[model samples]
Target: MFIRTESFSQYIRQYPVVSTLIALNVVIYLLSLLPFIGDPIRNFGVGSNYMIAQGEYWRLVTPMFLHAGIMHLLFNMFSLFIFGPELEKVAGKARFLTVYFLAGIFGDIATFFVYDSSYLHVGASGAIFGIFGAFGALVYYTKKMLPQLRQIILPIIVLSVVMTFIGPNINAAAHIAGLVVGFLIGLSIFHPKRIISWRKPKLKVVQKR
Candidate 1:
């Protein structure tokens, strides 16, 4: 189900929401590389508990699109790329966006409330974890029909959770918060009857005459 065989244009057409999100992330990351405005953008967008306490409320949402470095950007975007398209396909565009943004916002909120005022962070890890949570919910609701999905998804979720804690400089609170929020959102919106029929598209092989 996770393998992507679609051409680039086909993938974009089929999953506009995921494509756009990945594009936006890349654009924002590129903007942050500008010599003049780069630092300003990062300073303004980073999730800073102190700045948030001082009424920079936008920091919560902004950090979802900001990354600390190239590796950070690549890792989060890669996660989103791998996991996001399926959820977007299953959840539809509007619901998918709702899950993505809400999970990210709540994750940042958790960071703001749980961490010290001096704490600062920037990345899309929280939002990506939210996608993971949504997948967990999907497997939970549809496991009977797709019993094999549990075997596939469960290991990923567990490994992700373990890495969240053990990884140095990780934001465990945001990751956990995003995961919980995504799962809850998924439970509310996802129905087995609706998704049970959904299947990965089969790639047609061209025959040589």
Candidate 2:
């Protein structure tokens, strides 16, 4: 169930918010490639040790936007492009972005606290993982409406869990933490009842005298 297919876009115009995010990430990646700025930018990567240690805590949130390389950037952005629009369509732009940023922040914070020493870490994986979490919450909330999505839902969760164990350069722990935090946050903020209430606001009509 690749949401990037023509069928998904057939009825829904690409969410401007998500598209803009994708564009911004790409632009940032391009900016990081400039020679003068490239080295510093990659090291700073949304979170640099100096900045982080100096109590520029926002680095936790910012790091997720910076990718270490082209392949890293592409994979993260492509995953976001594929899964994000649909999640935004379901969850709305503001909420989706909130989860994205929060998840990234939490992921970095978790990694920072657990690791004894600092390492250069950057990428949208944390945020992308958040998107996956959001998708899980959305599917669970709308199980009655989206029962067909279970097959899609289960595999993603399973795959993510599996990837965490298949050790590599990937900060799978951060990804896991981000996903869990995002899922919990999404679940709390976007419960089934709240969604129904949000969707069905009482309309006020006024007649001109």
Candidate 3:
């Protein structure tokens, strides 16, 4: 389906939250590359499979901002550029941000279970995928309104699934986890009754002639 929302920059002007997130991810990635920048940034990454054992709960949130490399950052940022704005338009700034962090943390939680905590897991892909998941959720409940998107939904999902297989460090577990949580959040937020009521249909009664 065609993109019905405003352009990304226009959306940014209206809803600056998504722009801030993308900017943060880019800034962190650039910082990670700087030689003088040391373990302070490195410590933000999901370090060595360790859980809350030492009370490092911030790992849940910090990993979403850290990236393995420039390529990783770019891929995730591109995904956000494409999908984040529309979700923000539909869900509003607060809910949109909620979807991002909830999905990201859930994705990281999935990583904790799937990968070694000792393994360094980093990147915004988890959050990006969560946005994709939010899109999928909208496609589910709003199909009547977004019928055009119904046709493109499959191809979009296929592409994402294919991308997950591309690299050894892709962190599909986190991506898939983000998708699931985002989908559920979408369902909760865009439930058919609430959204349908939002568009409140007017039934006109015609007298029998």
Specify the highest-TM-score model's number: 1
Across residues 1-209, which tens digit of lDDT does each residue of candidate 3 receive? 23536676676797588789989888877787778774668765653357544678788788888877777778788778777777787888888999999999998888878876465688777787888787788888768887777667657776887879895768888889998899889888888777767688789999998
Give each prediction's root-mean-square deviation over alpha carbons: 7.5, 2.7, 5.9
Alpha-carbon TM-score of each model against the true structure: 0.90, 0.87, 0.84
lDDT of 1 by residue, 103-127 (tens): 9999999999899999999888888
Task: Please report the TM-score between candidate 2 and the true structure.
Answer: 0.87
The numbered model that scores best in lDDT is 1
TM-score of 3: 0.84
Where does model 3 exceed 4 Å of error?
Answer: 1-11, 196-209
Q: Could you tell which candidate, 2 or 3, scores higher by lDDT?
A: 3
The models' CA-based lDDT, in order, is 0.89, 0.77, 0.79
Candidate 1 Cα RMSD after full superposition onto the native fold (Å)? 7.5
Residue 114 Cα positional deviation in candidate 2, in Å, after optimal superposition: 1.2
Preferred candidate (lDDT higher): 1 or 2: 1
Evaluated at residue 26, the lDDT of candidate 1 is 97
Give the C-alpha lDDT of model 3.
Answer: 0.79
